[model samples]
Target chain A: MSLQVSKNGDVVVIEVDGQLIVGNRQELKQRVLDEAEGGARKILIDFARAGYIDSSGLGVLVSLAKRMRELGGDLRLANLNDDLQTLFELTKLDSLFQIADTRERALESF
Target chain B: MHAALDIRVPSDVQQIEAIVAQVVRRCREHRFDGRQLSLNVPVALTEALSNAILRGNGDAAGKCVRVRAEVTEMRLVLEVEDEGAGFDLEACTEDPTTPENLEREDGRGLFLMRSLMDRVERFRGDGNVVRLTLNRR
Candidate 1:
């Protein structure tokens, strides 16, 4: 998977492509931490290109959300696919994280 | 008659889902009715493989997880074996419905697997082996 980070004022947008599963968990986690440490509290993760997300991938998101919350910031998701959305809903993570339909919406949410 | 495939890869969590996808496609081609199964085998299998790759191997090179899939009586059975020291399944708290635990992350894989598969069993006595079975309904 490839991750791209862009900053728009106080909101940091992360675009993730390909699959988010066990293998890329660490990389994803580290990147989010870097963003948080760099002083970007509100993060918008774009999963429009993400095809699949497994449990480990969910774990990465949860961990990052916790980290961001502890730092007094927040993490939000955008462009989640139906399958991915089902996984999130089944795991009840849908209620835990703020999900938006577009990058602009997510950015506005923060 | 039944066919089987055995794959062994280093404990790299990144590669787990891809492999699971490959296996699921093959299983589907063999006429496995994935929809009838409670848990999408592809997703559940990926979760098992991820656990083996990430938590079991712990980023150690050379440590590997072995996966095998077989069909019997139109049912699919998947076995994931890891070389790492086994964990206590009973000790793992996997309640996904708990609000406090909901957003914390990192413990939902096992829960999802259990929820999706018809059968989920862990052999923690020796090497870690997670067995998942789904009947083509």
Candidate 2:
């Protein structure tokens, strides 16, 4: 998977393309942590083009969310497809993440 | 009729992509559509394969993970074996959904494999072998 980062005022939006699974979960984690370390308080992960995400992917997101909160930053998700949403719901992660329907809303959330 | 695919790879995390891609492609060829094609097939196969590489084989350089898949009209069956000590599925006790365990990253693969696939079985006569079965319908 490839991640592209862009800034929208104080919020940094990371657009992820391709699959987020065990093989590439570290890349996403590192990229997001880098942004957090760089002092981005509000982060948005745009999953518009993400085709697949496994348990490892979910674990990565959970770790990111926890780390961001510890650093006084936050991470939000946007553009989750049905399957992605279902996975979150089934795993009870839907409550842990602040999900937005669009990038604009996610950016506006913080 | 059954169409089979076989793969053997060193116990490396990098090899997971190719195996997952092949599983997705073959399942698609077997006419899995919609959510089954996109989420169920890829996610389950990836988790199973990742377990074999990372946990089962311990990422040993010379060790290998063997994967065999049989795709048919009724079901898709996959077997993943690793050249390491058997994995103790009973040892995994963390509940991924709980508030405390939600932030932990180490124990969710088995939960997902069981959740996404129709059946997940572990055998240890020769080596650690995990068999995953998913219904096409």
Candidate 3:
């Protein structure tokens, strides 16, 4: 899995290029935490290229969202595929975070 | 795809992704439902292995996780066992979706396993074993 960070206006987008599972969840978490530490107040995790995420990956996202909130910022998700979306809904996590349909929408939400 | 598979690996979370992928790949080869192959297999297997490695074995050194799979056109059954004390099911069913627990990261694995698989039954034998079944239909 790979992560790429891009800046759009004041929002920072972290794009995940592969499935997020236990093997690489820590790296994704660290990347976002680093972004938060570096003054990124609004972050969007773009998962357009990502097709899967296990609960550990979800855990990392939950942790990152909480951390961002504690820092007076927020984390949002965008472009989740149908399978990934079903996962969020199945775990009732769809209600926990703001999920957008597109990067443009997510960026605008920030 | 093998009609049955018995795999033993170290109790490390990092080993989970590949195992999940392999299971999903085999299920796909056997013509399991695409939905199960794409979503159910990987998610359920990942959760099972993660539970086995992290919660079941406590990520303890030298411990091992054992995985067994039986795949057929009719169904897919997987069992993951870890060499740790059995876990309390009451504690694992706390409803992570509840407002009080929504932000907590520790509970979703078990919930997803139950939701995605046709059957999720846990019992103790050599260790804590989580058996997951998915009907191919």
Candidate 4:
């Protein structure tokens, strides 16, 4: 998946394009970690363009959430479609991370 | 009756897209619902295929994952076979929802597979076969 990084105030928003699967989970993980390393405390993943994510992709998101929490910051997700929302609910990861419905709301959350 | 689909791919991670696409397209033709086509089919198939490739086959260069599907108006049945020793359904229990396992990197694929598919069963014949079924709504 191709990722585009932008800033809304201090919150860094990364827009993901395409399906997030095992083949591309690592690229997403490294990008988030890089943002954390660059002193971006609050990060948001905008899934406006992303269609769906596989289990591997969900695992990577879980790991990133844990890592960001340990670093005294957090990573949030926004603009997830209905299917993605159901995936997170089924896996019980919805409680582990803060999910917003829009980029503005996610930015406000951070 | 719709013709069954039979295909095979080497243990490559990149081929997962093509396989999922094929399964979804075929299921769609058989009147699978929107939720099944978008979420259940792709997520379950990806998990099953990736597990067959990476875990079951160990990503061996020569190993292949065989996929066979029988799609009817009532349901979609898919069997994914991997060139592995065997699979023990009873012994494969890892709860990713638990607090301890939540942060772990692995073990969610099986859960997702079971959760998405209507029925998931394992068999050992020529290879380890994972049968996934989704009933049409």
Query: Which digits, one per residue and each the tens of the lDDT, describe model 1 over residues B11-57?
Result: 87667666776677766676766453213786798888877776787
Candidate RMSDs in Å, in order, are 3.2, 1.8, 1.9, 1.6
How good is the docking of model 2, as DockQ? 0.77
Error of 2 at B120 (Å): 0.7
**Candidate 4 on B1-137: residue-level lDDT in tens?**
13388888888989999888998998888788999999999999999999899889998898899999889898888899999886787788888898878777778888998898889999985889999888999
Please give, for residues A1-110, the per-residue lDDT of candidate 1 as tens digits.
89988898888888899877766767888888988888889989999888677777888898888889899999999998777778888888888889998888888888
- Candidate 2: deviation at residue A22, Å? 1.9
Task: Write the number of the candidate with greater lDDT, choosing between 2 and 4.
Answer: 4
Top candidate on lDDT is 4
True contacts kept of each: 0.75, 0.79, 0.85, 0.67
What's model 1's lDDT at B59?
Answer: 65
Return the lDDT, model 1, position A14: 88
Between candidates 1 and 4, name the one with more favorable TM-score. 4
lDDT of 2 by residue, A7-68 (tens): 98888899999999877889999998888778887889999999888888998998899888
Q: After superposition, how far is residue B82 of candidate 2 from its true place, in Å?
A: 0.4
As for lDDT, the candidate ahead, 2 or 3, is: 3
| Candidate 4 structure quality by residue, lDDT tens digits, A77-107 | 9999999999989888887889999988888
TM-score of chain A of 2: 0.97
Residue A105 Cα positional deviation in candidate 1, in Å, after optimal superposition? 2.6
Model 4 accuracy (lDDT, Cα) = 0.89
Candidate 2 chain B lowest-lDDT run of ten: B1-10
Kindly give the stretch of ten consecutive residues in candidate 3 chain A with the minimal lDDT sum.
A87-96
